[model samples]
Target: MTSDGVTTSRVVADVARELEIELPTLSSRMASSFLNQIPALQGDDAVTQLVVASTSSNLSTVIDVLQHGIPLHQISVPAAAAAHARRFAQRELPVEALLRAYRLGESQFVQWCLRLLAARSLDAAELLAAVQEITSVAARYIDQVCEHLVDIYETERRLWGQRADAARAASVRTVLGDETLDVGTAEAMIGARLRGWHVAAVAWLQSDPSDAARRVESAAQLLTEAYGRSPLTVLADDHTLWAWVSGTSRPRLDEQVLDRALVSHPDLHLALGDPGPDLAGFRSSHREALKAKAVAQMSGGTTARLTRFATVSISALLLDRLDEVRTWVGRTLGDLARDDEAMAKLRDTVRIFLQTGGSFTDAAARLHLHKNTVHYRVRKAEEIRGRPLGDGRLDVEVALVICRQLGGGVLMR
Candidate 1:
């Protein structure tokens, strides 16, 4: 009998007997087709024995038949067995499969290596040999996957960076006073969220936007390290850097930190703002810093420092309105001092008189004259200037401030 016919008959009989079910006979064509599909099967002594034994009535007949000579363990449906083998070979699969697992693009080189590893179970040397065998195919895939991975990683990093930037902007806005915000509301918003206070020392490098940004970033890193909490944020303007610091307390911030941080770059001129409680204070602190920077610039020296807005008084600001004050002064005191030195003396006397708490005796003592002389100077000065030095005490005070700035009195040039 043909091998396929014999084998089918044996299997059907054995199964029917084991389950006590009625046997269904297989047709010759169907039996032959099934047998032909088994891999490595040949008409040999072992095959003949298995077919004969499997048809017997005993339960062990099927087992004994296969044990005659064939390796039953190795024999299985080729397609199903191949699929099972592939599962075991997954890790060793071609580079293509590896790329797929890693979400990389297709590459023939990787796929060939996987196939070779599966077919031969090769070691490192053999694997390298397999890789070499498919070099052209593998190299292309490797290059493609590598490039794709880099692009994907960079894209993801940029996206995350944007997210971080947005968060930082929101944090800054919340700290500063919004249109609907009051001092109490601003304080409450920052109270719990902020850990400390800090002041940022900002400077720009030759008006180059890139260099300015780098300097700001470098200064921020240095400050962060020194204070262990303070961080700097920079706002860019032409030839200017608005450096802001955030920390818990101004006193707690270490000046030495800034000294060292700024030491590395000589090109930067740092103007430090007051330590802000949170980012909201950045605006105020920045404003103060800009004024301080202007003061530093006017001083014509690098070491000049101004930390507080109060250091520069409103009087100083008024003095800055010199052009406007000049017109008024010229109009009021025009030619009054040309002939009457006494008139000039009276002007100085009136300033002293008001400054000394309206005491004639104190004014006389300050001016090194008798009290009557002081009173006479004030009356004469008021007559010449054509203005009463009456209860316009506020105007007198303001005028005195301008006089001092303009170097009026005996020192007038």
Candidate 2:
């Protein structure tokens, strides 16, 4: 052995002899106190094993540091940390609980060390050196173990989350696909039934469509919370989530629930499908949400974060013959299709006027305008089109409806 090794071995042996009687009791008390402080460390065999392994490894590290002047890096603390973290990950325990337990153990160990120094009645100079040694070694050990464990925990957690997500996505694809899979089997896989009134919703971010998958999950979680039930959720991509809320008795989509969800997540864009019954409803609902999403994009929907397929069904179907619809709108509205504040205000007046069945008084009340203002806009609209309302009342109403739904797309403005 080298001279250094011989000296280290002698010093370690001396300290071991001095603490031999107290070491077992000290370790047991420390472990007990740590577990008491972190009850999450109990209730599982894997957790118990991790606690035991960590306590023993930490005790060995501190003793070696104080006695042989061995470095913290040379110890098996990293392996212990990795093992403990793996156990926590497997048991699906929050990493915070493990970290809290470690902190508790650290405090208990320091308290034990201080008590030992006081009981031994060391001189002032000896006490100072001992205190310095305990503090330095304890700090280094705690920091090293925590750092190693945290890294391991995060890495393990990310891998686990990715695997779980991939598995769920695959199952959802199977159920949504045309494959001849049994509903029960699919339910077992996705943890939700297909035999119920299902209202499917797709959520995404407008700024970054690629962020769809992650943002969609947040949107789905918000929906689940508002509905007061767990919904079947699947990430269609990084920026899109498809989810369904169901009831045994066909339930209608509650507007208030959707309103609350939108209020909470202002930036989230949600497209919802009409509720349908049974497995066919499950497929149709998602299909309808997809259609609604497409129409919302074309219409330049402002304040349309929550687009319902039922509400947009007419527009979504009309979008199929968009070229023809645009031509018809141009012919019917003529200069009324102009994109400006004045034209927009005029169009609103005409729309409300027609909707109220040519009642100028009602249109004025609805638009919060005077009766003269509604009458003036209608005459102006007719003059711009070069025809009276009687000549093309049906065509004018249809054109106005198209403009309202398609916005600038059909208006060519």
Candidate 3:
């Protein structure tokens, strides 16, 4: 029977007649040959029976017969049939057709092979032998095709790797710009979304670059886990890594995140910069981080050190320019009896007094001196400096800054 209730015998007769050949005898031989070659076609099913009946017929005649049930346009015809009159010849398949099929199937086949290898179900030696044996059959068909497949596979792998790298670069840029937080509206948005207000601190590593990179990554992860947000940005240079953390409070960060991050590495030192308000603070935090490192280096601190720009006293600034300030102090007050200790005490008093907003009582309290004792000291300082101590707030403030910048022992106490 044919696929759509047409008889296979009738189809065979029509195809043979169209091809000017004998019908029943040719149909029987073709059916037997088809059944032997393709076991699945041996059944007396409609589609198989029709295909068996048409095999010995001319390709066009067979196509016409099949078109009653199957679309004729979808059938591929043998071009050689038109060229040869006596014997039928097969058509050459397009190279693109084979290549397209291989491209679609190669990835799935490779994955299957990899999975089989990983499972350890197949012996490695046996698998290699089997592959070699299979390649012998493949080599008979085409030597260059196998080489082409290898080249194509490698090209695809490289393209995939490049795509992955591009994705990572995009992710890094997004994170650095704080784009995920919508930084433009950060203050309002963060306050609403976060459980509490956020505080930020920055730390930098000046030592090991690899360790610094790892630490920055770890610190970012830790901050994210604790705060439900990655408040950290890690900018890594050739020799340093700058890490910033933002959350609700300073103490929590100091105890939980920064302190814990540094606990394992005794040799690695960090400079923790002052906490800032939002994403805008990242730049400031980074700057302060470098400054903090300088401060730590000068101070000879063992552990990680924290420094705040706001807490930097005028004396600290003055001490930074100690030599210049010391020269000026000596030249300006040359007639005074030269006692280093006394001059240092006077410098400290002036720094404290100026920093406390010109309040003698506040300065004395910071100096831990009696009010009258502070008064006597200020008068003696005025006499030594050859200037009156009254209403000289600006002069005193400038001198204190200069003295602190000088880094002299004058303001150490």
Candidate 4:
């Protein structure tokens, strides 16, 4: 009972009343500060208007509670406040921005109250009590409002993310399907350009499937890091991510980088397609990547983590008829296709020798062996096959590639 002969309650109430009148001014100032600080909030005219409305509503709501004696538990977030938070979630704006806005607003509002109290004819202790009361009430109101809004924002973000993912998945499926697509429309639907060369990739996690969405998406991004832009990625399933990168030219896969990524990512496997051009090229490239993935899956990860369509084209085509491929590999390479370490070395050396057009020196360089060792291995491979190197040169080379790519899948065990 002591501020310029005014009771403490009366003076505080009088100050709250004055603050109520200044709310419009306060809302405008805080809203400006929010836009300046949060670039995401700075949007079109309609968005700016929404921000003003939400800010004003929030300021007035807090002022009303301060001027009157309102119980916090009875309070709910202002409709405009809920709408603004939902908008942020729907637009994919981070919740951190909203929380930051609240923090800034709280500080400014408390300072504004302090300035007004300082202007009043009050003693230091009285001013401190009044300021404490206003600050506590304002801070508590903001804390309660922010907590509720956060719950709302999180709920909306989850629902929005699911809907967005479904829409994106549908668009991807339409583009991949045989629907007689218009390239322009398809590109718009998929939200990525269809021009230039396209390199398609399929990524999946081998373990830790619970983090499938995050880890699989990371795998696709990791595989296409050389493209210098984010690839168009879609979750094909819980554990699989399909992605395509477009650029002026085809991207070269860095084997060392890919191997390093595998170690960092843990149990991640990727299959890649050859780069193709334009809309039709997009479909063809994806088909090739799928084939490559099929081959990789068939090998049960005994193959490399990064499987390329260029190396496994034959294996991909024959993946469906693996038994037939096994029999053919057995016949073509004879005993040379045996799943034994010594036989494997001989088979590989002879395959290199034949691929180099019977050049022992070239094969030796490729195998990191002496020319004499290459010649000796070729002789042993021919003896095991019961034929001359020229008898079935083409078939021998193809069979050897299949054996190498498919490993024990096609080799006689």
TM-score of each candidate?
Answer: 0.32, 0.56, 0.34, 0.55
Flag regions of model 2 displaced more than 4 Å.
1-163, 179-191, 209-215, 225-228, 301-303, 390-392
- Looking at model 2, residue 400 earns an lDDT score of 77
Candidate 4 residue-wise lDDT, 1-413, digit = tens: 44452455566778779988777777878898988788777632224555787889988887777777677778899988887887677555678988898898899888888888888998777876777778888889999999999999999777766755768877777888756888899989988888888989888765545566688888765866545556888866545688888877876667777777677876778888999998888888888888897677655326468888998898888866778999998988888888888988897788888888899998899999998988888888889999987987889889988887777778887
For model 2, how does the per-residue alpha-carbon lDDT over 231-331 read when each residue is reduced to its tens digit?
A: 77765544457788888876555668768877766667888888888778888898888778766766654747878888778777786577788888888
lDDT of 1 by residue, 1-413 (tens): 12343443343334324323221222222223323443222222122222222222221322232223223333322232222222212212222322232221123213523553456444555445434433433344334433544444344334434533434434444554264565555546544334446455545443234454455455556556556664545333223344455545563456576567666765566565565654445556655555555434433224332233345343334434545765555455544433244545566787889889889999989989999988887777677667776646676565654453333321223
Q: Which of candidates 2 and 4 reaches a greater TM-score? A: 2
Better of 1 and 4 by TM-score: 4
lDDT of 3 by residue, 159-269 (tens): 433532334333333443564665545445323222233344344444444454455445455445544556534333212334445555542343465456556544445
Worst lDDT 10-window in candidate 2:
1-10
State residue 295's C-alpha deviation in candidate 2, in Å. Answer: 2.2
Alpha carbon lDDT of each predicted model: 0.44, 0.71, 0.44, 0.79
> Candidate 4, after superposition: displacement of residue 167 in Å?
1.9
Highest lDDT: give the candidate number.
4
Highest TM-score model number: 2
Candidate 1: deviation at residue 162, Å?
8.2
